[model samples]
Target: MERKVCAAAVQFNIELGEVEANLQKALAGIRRVREKDARLVVLPEMWSSGYAYKRLAALAEETPRVLEILKGLTAEKNMVTVGSLPEKVDGRIYNTAFVVDNGRIAGRYRKLHLFSTMGEDRFLAAGDAALVVSTSVGRLGVAICYDLRFPELFRKLALEGAEILCVPAEWPKPRQEHWRTLLRARAIENQLFVAAANCCGIQGKLDFFGMSLLISPRGEILAEGGETETELSALFNFEEMTSYRSQIRCYQDRRPEIYGTLP
Candidate 1:
């Protein structure tokens, strides 16, 4: 793994069901961040198509093309990126995050936690598996949107040797604190780096607050985006994380036998 790496998060308003426009915006963000020498990039959840639940199946058809373009871009730049998109398989739709590394598909993590309040469970099928995969940058653990609310998943990722957690989200307003706090807590407790991307602006009736964040193991915010379209970048040091883990000893002190074993 690289001792230090530059990571970036891309934030933008997603046009409902507009694949081409969203693709262009995401590509532009990636280009800008790459110029800053970012080796890894994370884009917002369901970027190619917003929560167009009625047309999710139709919109998912364009995901393969979007992935192909991303493959070409990562291959040319020799970088890795992650973002969630609608995936259609066997007539069922899933909110899946694709981790592209140097032109190849590294891994795909489906959204395990669906926002039932928004009727997400009605439209999308839930994922049963978690993803932590090796990439050109380092060991990456991937989760999407509502998964941030579940600390157990993050703990599992950390225990499985994930160096960085990449989260792609479309979180809305009136809950920005929850978004920020949970992300930092996940990093501090797990003692790893976090790069989370969230979209901004309005999509239908929902208003997204784009506070994309890059957090260190000590829970320090490295880079943060405002409530608009933007890109945030920061340098993450593996040595720093290792040192913090040694100092805190959160992992060593854990008594899973009493709390219940992680499945």
Candidate 2:
């Protein structure tokens, strides 16, 4: 049996350091998509607390209010949601993405590669592990903004049976080309779906390019957004992805022994 479902990526304008306001905006976006009966929804990184780290430590939430809200939303709407926020855990802060499925916390993936250019390395602790969570939709691999630049991470997830890679980003306008190209390349090379949710508006001096996208296994853009607050949705057929993978046979032809010796 082939499984197919509609998924959405939400793009919004995040106000810096305003946790409550940001939460409200994110909730509204989720509700708007639920009205259209989207089962899987993704939000950009730092949607709860905008990516201004100087004030992020003060704005960060130590409580699980964000998680609780997501749990309730997913349960009420019968949807799965993926979003990232500043997490204060045991006195350290992490850029963490939470997977809320059917009113429960499915898993959390912290940003493994911190953006040194933005001083993320100084403010947040980089995550040590890659994460893939199974859901009714499919096995989803979660990654944050800069993680898209690392193809190795996506490759590892695809090899581990990930059917979809959900990237929650706060990508800027200056590198919009890199954002689009990297996302398509990841999907094409890994032969899986890539759903990226990015933000709009500005945080300090950095202006975000809100080009949220949904891509197929063969590097096809299923849905895409522009530089505005919007939601992009697309239907994905797992059977088609499987058929494409079988035809390409890229995974089966891997010469792991030689490649593994490089590092």
Candidate 3:
């Protein structure tokens, strides 16, 4: 049996410290894709609150409010949604990604790799584990912006039976090439579909280039957005991925014993 699902990556401009306006913009982007029959929708990292680390304490929302919006939207539309935001829990902050399925909070992933260049290390506590959540859409793995640079995380998820990987990023304009290359590399190497949602517009002195992408298991660009506020979508077939994996057999040929000496 071939399982297939429609997925969308939403790209939008976020206002710094304006939670209400940012929420409205995110919801509007989701609504647009929902009309297109997207069963799984992904929003950019910090879509509700901008990535203004200096004002993180004041801008970050409690878990309740973020979940309420995500769960409500997913339940109302009967779809799955994934997005990252700044969460303040137990007097500590973490860049977390929440997976909402049919209005319920199915899973949460705190970003393990914090981007030091952006001062994420100073403002947020790093997550200790990788998150792979099982949902109606498929077995999905979640990663944040900087986490995409590490292939080991994606490989671990692949070994754990993840069929699709979703990444929400606030990737900047200067490193846009790295963003595109890394995404395609992850999909190709892991032999799974990769969907990345990135934000646009300027935040303080930094500018974000919105090139949200959906890449296939074979490293093909199925859908891609330009440097603007838009939504990119595509369909993923699990059966095709299965066939490719069987043919390649990359996972079966790993020499873990010899490569265990690193670090």
Candidate 4:
């Protein structure tokens, strides 16, 4: 019963004050996802620092060390892994998405949209590049935390031939409905696969809703995890995306001229 395109999400309760314990717990989930024959595995945002971006610079992870751990894990498990991490680059701390596959750091995506309303701008440096990593499974476009709120980034990725979108987020409570609504809307509109990995439990003063989802191109909820530390696993069909795009044909029927008509 091995599937070529199996996926899994780790919805873990990240212990806010215990980074070591959280890392250990999350490593276990990554291994579990591999054992289930998942070609792609996702972990929640800031699974290491627990969304404590205010202290990110002081506790930020080095690119090499994080890359080493993930490289080893992915090499041993032979699965693609993605999630958020606090990264220090060029003397600036960024909220980043680390992508590991086979035996190397495949790619990294930094959060472009700083959640200024939540004071993220005070802590983390925003990224400018839109990252899409190529893997054996497919081309994966990654966005971290608050980057999920931007439709333009996703559109650019779709145009760049990305088939699967990975959104690793620490989305909070009281806005749980928005999370689900936005995820489905993104999937349906883009005609691509969506895999959301969300953190559960409290970080500092914020509580995250861990209802991570794996959505089909047609916006069908292929698999979903509840608001707990659990795993959501499913097998996805790659052809469904192409089929939906052809049938919907929204991209073809675009009014690009009106968007930039030279008056």
Query: Candidate 1: where are CA atoms >4 Å away?
Result: 261-263
Please give each candidate's TM-score. 0.98, 0.97, 0.97, 0.94
- Candidate 4, residues 10-116, lDDT tens digits: the string is 99988764667777887889888878888798888877876565566665754456568778888987788888888888889888888888887789888899999
Per-residue lDDT of candidate 2, residues 54-135 (tens digit):
7777767632887888889898889999989888878789999998999998989999999999888998998999999998
Best by lDDT: 1
Better of 1 and 3 by TM-score: 1
Residue 171 lDDT in candidate 1: 96
What's the lDDT for residue 174 in model 4? 86
Task: State candidate 4's TM-score.
Answer: 0.94
- lDDT for predicted candidate 1 compared with the true structure: 0.95
- Relative to the unseen true structure, what is the C-alpha lDDT of residue 31 in candidate 2, on a scale of 0 to 100? 90
A best-first ranking of the candidates according to their TM-score comes to: 1, 2, 3, 4
* lDDT tens readout by residue for model 1, 1-263: 54999999999999999999999999999999999999999999999999999999999999999999999999999899999999999989999999999999999999999999999999999999999999988899999989999999998899999999999999999899999999999998899999999999999889999999999999999999999999999999999888888999988999888997657
Compute the lDDT of residue 172 as modeled in candidate 1: 97
Provide the clash count, candidate 1: 0
